[model samples]
Target: MHGALPATLILLAAAVLAVVACRQLKLPALLGYLIVGIVIGPNALALLPNSEDTSYLAEFGIVFLMFSIGLEFSLPKLKALRHSVFGLGAGQVLATIALTLPLAWFGHLPWAASVALGGALAMSSTAIVSTLLNERVELNTPHGQQIIGVLLFQDLAVVPLLILIPALANPAGGVIEALGWATFKAIIVLTILLYYGQKLMRPWFHMVAKQRSKELFIINLLLVTLGIAYLTSLAGLSLALGAFLAGMLISETEYRYQVEDDIRPFQDVLLGLFFVTVGMRLNFATLEQQWPLLLLFLVLLIPLKALLIFGLSRLMRSPSSVAWRTALSLAQAGEFGFVLIALAHGHQLLPPNLEQALLGAILLSMLVAPFLMQKRDALVRRFVASEWLNESLNLTQIAVQSMLARNHVILCGYGRSGQNLARLLEREEIHFFALDLDPERVREAAAAGDSVVFGDAGKREVLMAAGLSRAQAVVVTFSDTHMALRILSHVQALKPGLPVIVRTFDETDVDKLKEAGAVEVVAEVMEGSLMLASHVLMLLGTPLNRVLQHIRSVREERYDLFRGFFRGATDDSDDPSEQDQPRLHSVLITEEAASVGKSLGELRVAELVEIKAIKRRNIKGVEPSDEVVVNVGDVLVLLGRPARLAKAEARLLEG
Candidate 1:
């Protein structure tokens, strides 16, 4: 027991360091876990023993992983993606297996072992592909949808494969009888659990939830998951199958999201341990001697798999670019491949040397996956002439639309917030051009006569074609900080002085965006809170004028741009003289201007215009004191009536 504790600590410490390094390197955490296992396992440093107890604990990871997959399983989702999921996805899995089976058989492997190897080789990394796609904001793209659908089908395939692989290990040469009996058992157990379990699940959860004790709810959740798993094991099936059944039953209930939230920590930690155990099984000596075999397997895994998927995608009538991208994104072997390989090894269907080689190839393929996905666009553009043509046509369309547009706003996204801003701009008769990535949204909006185009605003050429040089301002309506920073970089390089207003989820990224040259950062959370507070105050009978003043003060404190608004034809009032009310304007102190070295007090324009703020390079919206000296290239933000503002600017520029 004492030795076990130290070994556990060592394992945990190694895992922590590996995961931290992976995070800093922007790689997947699962890869880190695998590396940790390889470095510390019996065949390497031997910090921990390759014991049955550890393997038994790791099996729970598979159970939880299957549970999570079942939680995400929905009949409607599968039906919606039926073509991609069943057609392309099914074809990919079956074809890869069919190709592998013959090769394994020719390599002198038994039929059972060949099938197991084929099943393991057929899987691709869902975790890596999904994360990269999400970070690139491509999850809604056509190829992205197809990639997800294929992954979904692969996840579903694991359940039956788990049952089949074990049955294939039967020594009695009655492989067909064993398979039939296993399938029958799975059907009967699933029917009983799913049909009868569904009826009991909701009411049982309701009763538990009514207890209103979180501890009780959690305890009951574990009981349900593990209890079903035990039942399935007793029925001579894998525990993972039962856990999957448990998750599927819970998915149909109102508590699905809560259950998923509750299960994630368990799923993630256990899944990491599972991958570590798989890594521990690797033999470095075997890898060193069989380098050629490893290379051969890597080729079969990545390029060959990619070719198969690409061909299948073309058969499905996908465009060449879309098919290539989908293929590249899903080319690497997945975590499930490890699970099946480990299971096969346990069943004595796979030899140790072959397993090590397969593991090495899968690991290497995963390491190469991120780079492949990142370079997919470049590759597609180089190889697929149609991709370049499509991009050229898109840019041409954008340029033609904006050729006659001057002083127009460039909207970076056309989602809900962008649409609202567009409507307000239209009401005020302001010219605006919108760029959106969603093809359907762009088509529908353009069909309704909206000035929008299908293009990525982050691209330099796209922004140029959208009239960035002639734009009055740019508004980034999407709340992606990374993409917003990229757009800010392009804007600063192309047109330094044009104001770019960015929207974010909260104040967490306000300073970051501002430092990147955004003139204003609007936080939706802050706006929502202000609206909530204002409504509450009004409901409490606070005077309207007082409430408005409070809201304005909050805005002024939070946003530099809210200090004043530029006067326009839209600023109407009962009296015509109100049009001359104090408004904001910016004056640039050029090197040749009279105000180049003047102090704020010596400006001699206080009565004409108030100095609201001074914006210098790398600093924005700094309040100017009377004794503050002005320098060349400074931007003076002034507030006064239009005629007074004109005089103030002339005095500052020409003395």
Candidate 2:
């Protein structure tokens, strides 16, 4: 027991270090887990023994993974993507297997082994591909949709394959008869569970939820998931199949998301262990002896798979660029491929040398997957001529829309907030051009007489085509801080003085955006909270004028731009008496300036312009005192009327 404790600690420590390293290196945690297993397994350093107990525990990882997949198995989603899921996705999987079966059979593998190998090879890394697509904001693109559809079908295909593989392993009764009986049992079990399980799952979950104890809810969730799994195992089916059924049943209920959230931690840890066990199975001796075979397998896996997918996508009428992207995105072997390989090895369908070779090839392919996806755009552009023409035409459309407008606002997003702002602008007779990425949204909006274009505002060329030089201001209505920073950088490069307003979800990024040169950042959460508070105060009998003043004071305190409005040509419409309203100006204390080394009191421009702040080296000191000394590189933030501000700048530079 004591020895076991140390081994467990070693495993935990290694897993943590691997995950941290993977995160820092921007690689998948799955790779890290596999590497940890290889380094510490009995085949290598042997820090941990290859024990049945560890392998048994790791099996639950597969169970939870299937459960998660089951939760995502929505009827409506499949229906919506039926063409891609069933047509392209099924074609990819079936074609991959059909091609592999002949090759494996030619290599003298038995029929069952060939089928198993083929099933394993048919999968692409869902974790890696989906994450990269989301990060690149391409999940809604034509190829992204097709990629997701294919992945979904692959996940669903694993269920039947799981049942079939074990049946093939034991053909004592005869291969056909064994498969027939296994299929019968699976159908019967699935029917009973699906037919009755749905009826009981919702009410059962409701009962648990009514208990309102989070601990009890989690306990009940595990019970249902594992109980169903155990029942399936009792009926001679895989535990993963039962878990998948359990997830599908619960997915029809309101508790599906809750169940998913509760099950993720368990799934992640166990899944990592599962990958580790897979890595341990990889014999370094076998790999050393079979390096050429591993290399051959790697070559066959990536390019052949890519070509196959590319051909399939083109056959389905996808553009060359879209087909290339989809092919590159899914060319790598998937995590489920490892699962299938492990399953096949467990069933003794694959030899040790062969299993090791396949594992090595799959791992190497996954490592190369990210690089391939990163270069997808470049590769597509280089290979596909239409891509360049498409982009140029898109830019032309944007330029045509903005050519007639002068001193108009440029909205970086045309979502709900952007639409609302456009309405407000329109009521005031202001011209604005909105940019959005969703083609559907752009089409509908343009049809509705909106001055919107389909374009990625983060792209420098897009902003240039949107007439950034002629625009009075730019407003980023989307709450993506990274994209906002990118736009800010472009705006700063093109026109540094342009006032760009950014919208964020919360104050967490307000300072960051401000430092990135945004004239102002409006936080949705802050504004929502202020509105909520104002409503509550009014309901509690606070006077309307008092509440309004309180809100104004809060805004003035929080937002520097709210303290005074910058004068524009439109300001002439305001009251004549307000023409001298105090405005803000910045004065840079250069080496040639007289105020370079002088204290605030020495400048004596306070009567004309209030020294609001001192900004030096990206740091701002609000309401700087008279005793504060001004340095050569300091920027004095002054507040005064237009006339006073000009006079104060001259006084500071020439005194």
Candidate 3:
């Protein structure tokens, strides 16, 4: 017990010092904690007496880390990026494994070891990348989103790889039967966890959460994380895998955020311990003796992996400027390499020297990760300037559409929402460039001859590349409020007084976004108000002239209204445009019985509206031309003066 006290004290002290150092240096605390472990480890100070205990804690940390990742790794996010995460992710892993296996075999490793090394090396550090992105405030950036999507797919990849490992371990046995048994156990465990664990965990968490005791909350967190982790491992899987499952289960509950908050302190501490243990486990003696082998591996293996990533990214046709940097950033070995190598050693699947080589290779790669990420730009520049790296960089720059003019529009995000807005802008002859993160969408738009910029709006560099520095007005059509605010702030900082319109999925985010400098906020809930204000005034028997006047003024004054909505007591900046006289535009679609079969051109809507399109319910397709007919299920979308739109509704709809 007395020996335990010194160990505990020393560990705590190391944690404190490392945390402080990390904070001071603005680096990730996890890296600092790892350094702490390396310093006090047996190779260094030798303060820790029990290596086995550290291993157990490290195992627990693995469970908790995966669980936390699962909690944040939402089903909703997956659904949103399913095509990329699953499609690209699966392709990358398979291609890497297939290509590397023969090379490994040629290197004199057994086929199983070759495949195991391939699987281990193919998986990147989701945890490390996630933390790094958060630390760098890049989570919502296009590159950040892509990295995350790819990592999630990588995590999902672990499922198949897990099943494959044991089969490879027992090649003589009937592989199909072993796979079936393994799958059956996995399903039973998953079903029981889904059916029962969820049922019990939430109410139990609620009760614990209601206690309002921080100590109890921390204990509950560890219990849930460790308990499920233990249960899952008992069913024949990595504790890390179980932790992820447990997190997903808990994520379904309302208490998830609370659980996350409560787990923070424990996560921080245990995560530090985990990294430290990882560092301590590093066999530095061998590294010091065979520095040449270490250098050779770093020089040979790192570049090979990086080149593979670059080629894959190019084959996928990621952004011209971004692809190389992305490959360089993620090309290094991740935490899974350690797990796979250790597992192989435990199972006697690999020789000790080989395992040592892999471990040394992995640690060295991790040490290089921060440098690679930090110097990404310089590396990119160097890669572009280098004759060796110039092949990939010499590819075409992103095909961009021009949005040049005073009052030129800038549409950020080319998702479904942006697409709809672009259609409207097109009909209006509004010259605007649509910025989208998806390379495919950008390609699609380019092929279609639409003006689009394939870049992230969150980055000042990307935005500058998109001509946002000269944009007359910027419109954010994506749903991420944090990202929207960041764009808004940057736009305002770059060109003060630029009118920026932002879209919000809910009214809840309106005040926050507006306060962040959005000139106008369009919450989807208020969409009906555009139609509602017209009818309500007509029903009230207000003069049509007055009604039209009110609606147009609202449309024009909305920007000013939002601009001044949050001024504090001492703030004297009132938007002057809100005080302007009302102006109205009326659109009335006349529905004549005879005009129903005719398109807008035949109806000569130009006599009523310069622009209008039919809005179809639950569908996305263009309205037919004058030569084509309008059927019963269409609604005319006419743009004109308030009175004109109201007056021509019948003519527009019928046409």
Clashes of each: 0, 0, 26
Query: For candidate 3, lDDT tens digit of each residue in 175-276?
Result: 567768778888888899889987898899889879989788877777878788778778876677778887888898897887888777666666667778
What stretches of model 2 exceed 4 Å from their correct place? 506-515, 541-558, 564-572, 576-641, 644-655
For model 2, what is the error of residue 414's alpha carbon versus the real structure, in angstroms, after optimal superposition?
1.9
Residues 1-655, candidate 2: write the lDDT tens digits: 9979998899999999999999878789999999999999999999988899999999999999999999999999999899889999999999988987886657888778888888988999999999888766677778888999999999999999998898889864587787888889999999999999988988888988998999999999899989999999988889999999999999999998989899999999999999999888888898999999999999999999999999999999999998999998999999999988888988999888889999999999999998999898889999899999999999999999899988789999898999999999898777899998877888899999999998989889999999999887899998888789889888877765567899999999888887777778999998998999999999999999999999999999888777765554444656656887787776778899988778878888897877766656544533478887777767676788889988899988988
Candidate 1 on 493-554: residue-level lDDT in tens? 78765678999999898888887778889999999999999999999999999999999999
Q: Candidate 2 has which clashing residue pairs, if any?
A: none
Candidate 2 lDDT trough over 10 residues, lowest sum: 614-623
lDDT of 2: 0.88
List where candidate 3 sits over 4 angstroms from the true fold: 22-26, 131-142, 159-180, 198-218, 317-319, 378-655
lDDT of 3: 0.67
Q: Rank the candidates by TM-score, best first.
A: 1, 2, 3
